[model samples]
Target chain A: MATTKTPSRLVLNGLLNENPIFRLALSMCPAVGISTTVMNGLMLGTAVLFVQVCSSCTIAAIKNYIHPRIRIPTYTLTIATWVTVIDLVLSAYAPEAYKAMGIFIKLIVAFAIITMRLEVFACKNTVAMSFWDGLGMGLGFMFGMVTLGFIRELLGMGTLLGHNVLGFRPLLFFALPLAGFFCVGFMMAIFNYVELVFNRRKKRRG
Target chain B: MARLRRITYLTLGFLLLAYLLVFSGCAGSQNRFIKKTSFRGTHSILITFAGPVDEEWATKASNYRVYEKPDPDIVLKISTIELSTNRQTVILHFEEPLNQNQPHMVTMRGIMTEGKSVGTAIVKVRKLYLGYLFSILIGAMLVQNFVFTKYLGLCVFFGTSQKRSTAVGMGVTFTIVIVASAMMSWFLYQFFLKPFHLDFLQIIVFIGLVSLSVQAVDTILRKVNPMLFKAFGVYLVLVIANCIILAVPLILADNEYNAAESLMLALGAGLGFLIALFLMSSVRERLELANVPPTYRGLPIAFVVAGLFALAFLGFSGMSIF
Candidate 1:
């Protein structure tokens, strides 16, 4: 984490090295729960991004005021406030999307990934650094969700973005909640393997 | 102190075991109990049985006859009975839908249940509120277990469920928090959101309520019961991220359950979480020794185990206490 001294490095670290969902394995609940469709994934990712950036900036701006003992609750308050703002905005601007993602949009409050970033990155870092870190981490999370959603939606329903690209639904099992777990499990395993290979190659080159 | 805690654990374990055994042993065919009857549309009548019905009899149109209550002349001929995928509900279609709001009388004569019980019931809306509550409890626990079936709270499920002791401790802590937060959210939504037209703010309100409840419990436990504080205080923070804690309130608001029903749902959900934790922890502790592939060892294997558990829980769906 300390290696991420530059703003761009922080963002890159969050994007690939410490990808919130795949690498860090944080926020798997929301990551897998609503990522059944790409649109769902994109919306949730955007909400997470907005909340992450705002909460991180808020925590960075007022790091000294919050006593260490009550920091978690305070951070949670900031995240919840941001979540509410995005939630209301989505409802006002995109009622249809809001309806589809209404129940879950509220649940971004409990995403372990957001709270984790605030504690680990936001409080210790400067506001600008926190913003970049939040952007990077949020993008990383968005990337994971979209990938999972792409896999599930494409294979489960045999459709891409609600379009019947395959001309037929295949393995409708992927739409079920249990299938979400399996997809995530396999995805995480693949992620681990790829990361291992990447580090091995890096070591050989070094 | 150790003995007391041991006894409590033993008793709770025994109760859970007995509940499961008794219910499973009684897994005979459900009695032909009429759960509900209502008008589906202008031309159809919906009949919902408490459990899976004998499809052969349910589909047979000759077994059912429908007529208006005030007069026998007004009879709606059953064109066909379309059974739902679950087979517990069958919608009776007609040439012309029953448009009148008057009460309708439907009768069945042949075998309708798995036990081959002769079906007989005066088509009426039975006030089975108590039965409804009981079903809600069972539904939440086994049929729709949040962790295994609904797939909520996996973070804590996989995280704290590594060891049996920690799993039990976390499960107990989660139960208290979910119940408290669910009730608070229910109250806040009913009084504030629904009344004042501020439903959009429920997520924020719920987060605040859950965090406050956890904080309140934290302060109280620290002062009032040091032993419990030591045991569960560590888990209090984890409860915040538990999807189950937040999901319960969202569900209650979606369903618009009354105070008593919400309480029952919360209590049942809490116990269900405990049951799921106990089951998973026991299996996982054994998996610790098993030979697993390198990549699938820690969490990947656990996810597969959870999927298997989900399949097992699916069997509980068709089951009925009646």
Candidate 2:
């Protein structure tokens, strides 16, 4: 699979086809939980991106040594260790963001997307490929989270990353968990629709 | 092959033994049963039990003795020992007002529950407001719902909600697993982690316990009732990865809730998930027949409906139930 796919394709796959939150619908917990504000979403996404890349790179490097029978636990321990390290660092250095995102950060250890990447791509791929895959997937997650965060923040609070955008009272519902579903759903629809039209135009011209 | 099987069995047996030893060792410690003491008011301090105490044993005034520490002369007599309806909380009424500045030692000797002795427990009273438990419940259910509010288990939330039957099954399973795991995790956190100052390891420990219990439940269900297991087995396995199961304990620990409050929060959160799933599934069933654009079909439409539902649920906010 890695042989056929170019590095750019892999990156694009992560950002588009296999986008963890929007396309594959993985890790929606943090996406909804922390995406009430753009800052919260960005911070949580950064944490996940860091953990995902580190875990991917490490798993790729050590895939040969891991026993098949115990691979799941080993992978889980790896994610947990990285999450813990990030948790400690965030709490010590970025105390305010840590206060807002502490619980969500701890939850990164159990995200299926991270484990899925390790099992599906990282374990079998080269270290360099795995790094790219990780980066793409992580960036994809960050993009989805930030998008959701941006929408929710804009609608709910009439603000974007703490700046007052709208002068009136916001919908307020967009800030809630229920609206997260709506925002993602509509965004997904628009995304697919545009892709469809884009493909149609390309086909007609060709 | 036989040797390998033997080795596997031996390893499994050793792991079980170690788990038992650690759990029993933690339970054996006096600190396990006695949680913390808090001032409910000027005259009373609420002593929380880690688990439900025997109502009969708890009601008996002679079982509990409170003394102002370092001052035997200031013996505070128990006026009334009120066991909460949940059976986890025991509100001790004292004749003499507790001094806010001084500390009090509560001793429960041989508190028997369900034909077994819980042994002795001694805890120092600390300043904790009891009024927040209600807010925690409302907040967990309505304000910070695991599904609609926090988005803990969206995979299951969206995956099972297409069919009403599956949604209900998932809801029941989720409620049971979440509440049970929350209680178990609380016990593990309080008795094991708190005593050892291993609080930082909570995330790993809580997730491990949740996954292990889910596995245990799956196996036991398969053995005892194959039909029920067959219906919910796949969903149960999927639940191990469900964020809500892990989130309950994490939220409970983050908020520093006692056993009773943790149970309530768990129940509330689970109920919230159940309500959200049921609503979404029912709406989707209707949505299936509705004419829609190609792009807005299926999950995208379901999400839009869910957003509307979320908007409806937002009405529950700002409600001062307490």
Candidate 3:
């Protein structure tokens, strides 16, 4: 596995191949809760990016020491500790942002995407590879969230990042949690369709 | 070897930064004098402070004053000031009943803490509405639904919502577990965690409580009704990891709702989940018969339907019965 794969491939795999939200459908709770506005999406994405990278790197470094039988609980404890640290830091330095995103931040402790990454990539890979994978997955989640937030905010509230973009909300339903399902599902289908077309074109040329 | 060493150093550095932030966070926010306030009755108010108040300085009537708007001349007399045993809460008793319609401003000046004046805090007392129970029910069930609004419990929601019967079973089990866990966590939080000031450990504690209760319910179900357990045993275990289960308790704790309100919230949230699951399962069952595109047949189409339902529920957003 190590001989054939490159770090860049690992990163790309997370971004396009196995995005946490659009592709794998993990951690949809926060994806819906925080995607009401573009700013919220970006903020939450940044927070997840920080926690995902740090936790993956740490898990990779300590993979040898963790017992296989109890690795799940250990992973949870590790994630919880990092989430608490981030929660405290945000509340201290950026109180206003923390107030808006604090509950969602704490909810990251139970996110399946982080756990899935730790188990699938971080445990077996080197620290560098795990870090890249985490970074890529984080970026992918951020991309999905920001896109969803942008469309939802633009349509639901007639704003983008609180700036008025439309005179009236076309469909306020986009801002609701139910819209998250529709957005993610439609996005996944479009992504798959695009990938299919790209692959087919490449195959024809070859 | 160099790369490994760098990784080690990076991990250690991050840990050190995290430690520093944790300690600094406690000290940095301690200077704020007032925490929050709420109404105890029509006439009285309960004020909570950031730290323990100096009983000698806080008990004096002159330190506290209540004013009405516009004129600002009516000073409601303080009949008594009672400090809680923890000294974090002070109950101010007014001589006369306050006007329910007019907003009153209560100011406590020169609040001493550790032999130093921590400045003053003025709080506006809005009239307390008594229909919080009804509003919480409507809010949780409709406005901020656990499934449709918050996107919690999706794993179980999608997993068990294929058939209507299974949906009903999972929903009932989920509601029971959620309400039970909410009550348990509320008791633990109010009596032990908050009093001891270990509120930071709430996440770990609440998760533990929820898992334990789920385990208990699992055992009871298996023994009492083996058939029902067989239907929902897998999802019952999944409840331990369900975001909604943990979220219910966490939200209740964060909002600091009283016992009745928390129960109502749990009920509303649970009912909301049940309703969403039931609706989704019924729709999916019908969708099985409808001809659709190959790619959008299953989950994608279901999502579109859920979105339409969400749009319908948006009509309830403007409803303010209270």
Off by over 4 Å in 1: A1-3, A198-206, B1-126, B223-232, B318-322
TM-score of 3: 0.69
- The sequence of per-residue lDDT tens digits that candidate 2 reaches over residues B40-117 is 877887877777788889899888778877795766888887889878788888887777545577788897766699
Q: With candidate 3 superimposed using the best TM-score fit, by how many Å does residue B188's alpha carbon deviate from the native?
A: 2.1
Q: Which pairs in model 3 have colliding backbones?
A: none
Q: Which sections of candidate 3 miss by over 4 Å?
A: A1-3, A64-70, A124-126, A154-179, A195-206, B1-135, B218-232, B318-322
The sequence of per-residue lDDT tens digits that candidate 3 reaches over residues B112-157 is 9888987877776644433545677778998877777566777667
Q: Ten-residue segment with the worst summed lDDT in candidate 3 chain B?
A: B22-31
Candidate 1: Cα lDDT at B293: 75
Predicted structure with the largest TM-score when compared to the true one = 1
lDDT of 1 by residue, A67-180 (tens): 998898888888888988998899899998888775677778888999999988899989999999999999999999999899999988888888888887788888776777
Which of the two, 1 or 2, has more lDDT?
1
Model 2 agreement with the true structure over A39-133: per-residue lDDT tens digits: 98889888998999999999999999999966866787888878888998899999999998757888887788998899999899889989989
Model 2 per-residue lDDT at B284: 89
Candidate 3: CAPRI quality band: acceptable
DockQ of each: 0.53, 0.52, 0.33
What docking grade does candidate 1 earn?
Answer: medium
